[model samples]
Target: MPDASRITPPVVAPTEAPVNPVSMHIRLDPGMPLAHLESVYHAVNTEKNAQGIYQLTLQDAQVPANRDFELLWVPAPGNAPQAALFNEQWQGDEYALLMLMPPAPAPAGATARRVPREVIYVIDTSGSMHGDSIIQARAALKLALERLTTADRFNVIQFNHQTSALFSRAVAATADNLQRALSYVDRLVADGGTEMLPALQLALGQQPEQGVLRQIIFLTDGSVGNEQALFSLIHQQLGDSRLFTVGIGSAPNSFFMTRAAQFGRGTFTYIGKVAEVGEKMAALFSKLETPRLTDIEIHWPQDQPVEMWPARIPDLYLGEPVLVALKLQQPNLPLTLTGDAAGVPWQQQVTLRGGAARSGVHQLWARRKIADLMDQRAQGVAEPEVRKAVLDVALTHRLVSRYTSLVAVDKTPSRPADQGLENKALPTNLPQGWSATKVFGSLPQTATASEWNLLVGLLLLACGVLFSRWPGVGFGVRVGPVSDGKAHGGNVL
Candidate 1:
């Protein structure tokens, strides 16, 4: 055959490697128009697997400047004109899902009054947060202190190997106290191992002052490995106090920060760069000063079997809405949500009806269930049972979890039997406004291990080609030489 493969030679190397892929799952009202989005995201690989469920894969995804999803409603079957609930048929299923949005905040100059806050700032001074992390944290704490009014009482708690409080107890937000706090924060330095349990114990164990909104704002790089223990401590001691975690570093453990806040019945915030400290802290302060919706309870119809995630709802802050997901055996039931805003009773009710069948709703419910199970596991639930439950949910939904990961393998092996695979770590960028030299004591190299591997592969491939062309060289021809099967070349060994 005169070596047909040799007659039409393939290119051995690509000019550039492909970018990393980003995946997104979205659910909307079934049959909604998608032409506009298709045009905008032309390069994305998008497909609708089921009604109202879409999967999108894009290379090197970037955030859109304007992105929003507004829920669509349709008239319910046999629904009264005056009925408060509206429904759309679930696109592909028999079950109907109900949604209710809380009433909007009262207009400015309304009767609602701001609550007095008792604030405790918990800061981490671990060795990993030696430089830019500590600097930005101090700046953020100072800004928080400045936002305190005379009506507020405040304390500062910093932790490393041990914990210390700036005052014996939370003191009035007086001029003298504020200045002393500022000086105290300035003199703080980062050192020692992270021992967060003691800090959290001190912050939450204090007897809460009656009628005051108690909040603990925790700032840290979230580098500790013993997350389960900390979560247990927070749940045990978190009587009437809320713990809000502020992620502080170029890379923080997002899973820990988010789940900790969820368990603490509070919200989480992130300040990735020094410049964002002011903006984020200001927003947090606004939420702190506003009247919150508390003691939230959702009343489902007594007759039907209903399952809902997030058994306990967190208090709602200003401009925040309440969302819950549930699966019901029967339809056409009424759901009532009740809460208190500034001691004024507030309630909203919505009747259930078949809505456009959305694809990802089931998966969303599954994720929440898995998260709840994890929280239970952290709080002394049986390990084997919880692990099995989490694994089942994760595998069913094809979602990644601590125990399960998403992995792909090719059917065909491209490398020689003698070849060895190399692994490398990827390098992440420093946060904006942070100096590399200051953070690391010197400017560190930015090249990732993958880049080095690619370079070495190219060099070896070049050498192979040169050796193959030699007069006396004779080797069995393989179409591709790259371990990943993405490169085309003949192996010479």
Candidate 2:
């Protein structure tokens, strides 16, 4: 019988490399209000033209002439900001990329409800707030108060190294009462270290009663050092009261303020110029009147493997409702959804199949928001397992997360010396644990000292023999074996 080893086939190990998942990061300019939705879509589909304006074409984004997405817009405070939601289900993993379209400009004649709102202006009077920061903050508060309707209720809370409430709780928005509150705001002088945690705690402690649209507008210009602490404090106290944040100064710690507002379920506005305060206040108050749409929710049933970015965050913005796009495993069913608006919910559904996913650019935006949410509070999770799960998903998906960035998962080794050169072609003739760049397509320097000496000796011996055996006619002149002697002086020497 033939030997078993000779008869059996060799097991060839697979050499295929693993594929990396692709993710796209698109930035949405918060400057655009609502009128720019079409422009946003154009920007999404076509390349910007010479003037930086988006050129719209039917072929762009593969949108048909009659194609239109169900538009839901919600107005909010700051810059006439509107939420946009686009619902569609497209097939294929290729379409699972994130797309952040630019926000549109504000539209005309947009209105909100005229409900009673109680707003508390929390001004940071820390010593650091001294100067233009305090001045601008006071002006911004005054401007915001001017925009408030008579039916609204208001109060002022000033905090620095400590917390100070104008009154124990909220007060009615009366002309004389508002004037008295403005007087207190004008007297605010910044002169203490930012112990923002205590101030925030105090503000959150006074929970506004029900049926009142309670909000706290926090203005700051410096780092409090206890940002995470403040976020936790706010999250703990979060219950009906929304915390809007206004970042003052040219270079404030925006990350802290932004996250603070986000955690408090409020809006964030940045003041680039002093003059912007009134406009921002007006825009914010305008949102108070109109019910953009209530009961805002994203409905993607768990029938298939569906992932929505920003799964827990609020809706997307157009000019009315936030723009939301969903990715679906089965698009033929036409995914339908609704957003609750000030107790009024709007329903929308769309069917997607086959090539429809390619046109469903909104789905990419959804994934991106989800990525943002994942990275938002990685440190806050109680369990390392949960944090690791989020981090792993973020790493695998390449989401722009704070906790898990692209470089977070280090495939590279910590110590270069410890890593052996991973050469696929080099044979393992090297000593164990030895790691060096293996020379390829070249012979190794294997000649020992003795061998080298022997080679040189052999070469010298050949040269000496050739020189001695040469036939010479005269000293320093030689005649070859077949030379016809011509009496040439310069003959072979």
Candidate 3:
């Protein structure tokens, strides 16, 4: 036989060197001449608008104009997984992106339900939750209570360093219970460390009432550090309960609260302003009142090699759809989705063919994959394996994960190693009508809360709830502060 290895042609990279990989860190010297400084400022700040530059006439994302939930296949260019061999692209195994847009919410008058419910209201009273966050939480809790019917059973659990419940067990949402619960909520004060695990345990650890929709509406600024511990607890103890997370504040821990809801098999809602509490909470409560779809199953064409994110599919509520990202050997095939919607067997089908490819599908898929990996890490997967896997995906997709970070470094040192650097701290501008940001997550970092920050929170809510809610691929571009002094760089994320 001929030498097979020699017969095959060798694959070569498109370029011998990286085209654009390095991010530069530049600083100006304080001792620079005035003319040089002025020139530098003008050159950096001036935006030379290209006169009538040719722009792509094509629209970016291939989403329908209507709100109807449609199953879509967003294949990569030529079914590719990466762009270039290096830089601004993911060099990894090839796959395609699929999205299942959620159905629009049920009609306002429709969703009158007879099935019973057990609603658990958990609020964070940690010191960081003081001010607007606490007020928002209290108002949200009160609204949820008013929506509860007598047929529903409910309890209120508040936690800081300590955790307490309004009832030893879930009580009927009667006049008396509602009154007492309101009284209990009114006395809550934000003045302790954020101890969330015990509260989660109290909310999810208990057994469910037979034939009742067990739902937990958790309200918090999400200023907690023990995310892994809390996620594990939610995963283990969450037998049949659904969790809905309400992120309360301008810059709450969207990562923690969003993932917590994912693990608890629920959705995330964000209340940015006190004015938004009424509308957003009412919308959420409307969905809560409706019956949720259960026992969902996706049937792909026979014997196709399938690798999908969200290995376990959760039940869907009203306004929530079945969104999935996966890899397939056969891209052009039929797909079937089956589920139980309020005791009714519901199934939908779509033939995989296309109009146009969606933008950033690979990033969306990689994002879901990273979240899945982090879920494994939180569920006690070996640290090294999870880290390596996450790093591969994160680095390949150019995303920020627990395993990867965006860094800025000044390669050239400004002073001698033995010299100490000192400077006066500049005053940070916070958003109007907000207190200082609360430190959150495994590591501590401070961020200024603004209308834009709340917008970020809304975008991070849930993938199933909205196709646009995928984790952002990168950070915002910020223009550095204008100054005559020498510039120094620090890692922002």
Best by TM-score: 1
Per-residue CA lDDT of candidate 2, range 1-493, in tens? 1122221122112232222222222323322233333331122433444443343333333332111122122222444222233344333442333222323334677444466777878888865455556777888888887877877777788887678888777778788888888888878887744567777777788776678778788888644655556776777787888887887754456767766766776666666446556765666655544435444554445666555654554533323334344455554544445555445545654434422223435435534555454434533665555566666645555555556554446678666786776634322222111112221112233312356688899998888788778886223545544436554444454
TM-score of each: 0.68, 0.58, 0.66
Clashes of each: 10, 56, 0
- TM-score: model 2 vs. ground truth: 0.58
RMSD of each: 16.5, 25.1, 23.0
Please give the range of 10 consecutive residues that has the lowest summed lDDT in model 1: 75-84
Candidate 2 weakest ten by summed lDDT: 432-441
lDDT of 3: 0.65
- Cα shift from native, residue 225, model 3 (Å): 1.2
How high is the CA lDDT of each candidate model? 0.68, 0.55, 0.65
Comparing 2 and 3 by lDDT, which wins? 3
> What is the TM-score of candidate 3?
0.66
Candidate 3 lDDT tens digits, 41-132: 01122222244112221122232111111111222222111111100112343354434333444456764546789999999998667778
Point out where model 1 deviates above 4 Å.
1-112, 130-132, 354-356, 395-398, 405-407, 412-414, 420-493
Query: What's the alpha carbon RMSD for model 1?
Result: 16.5
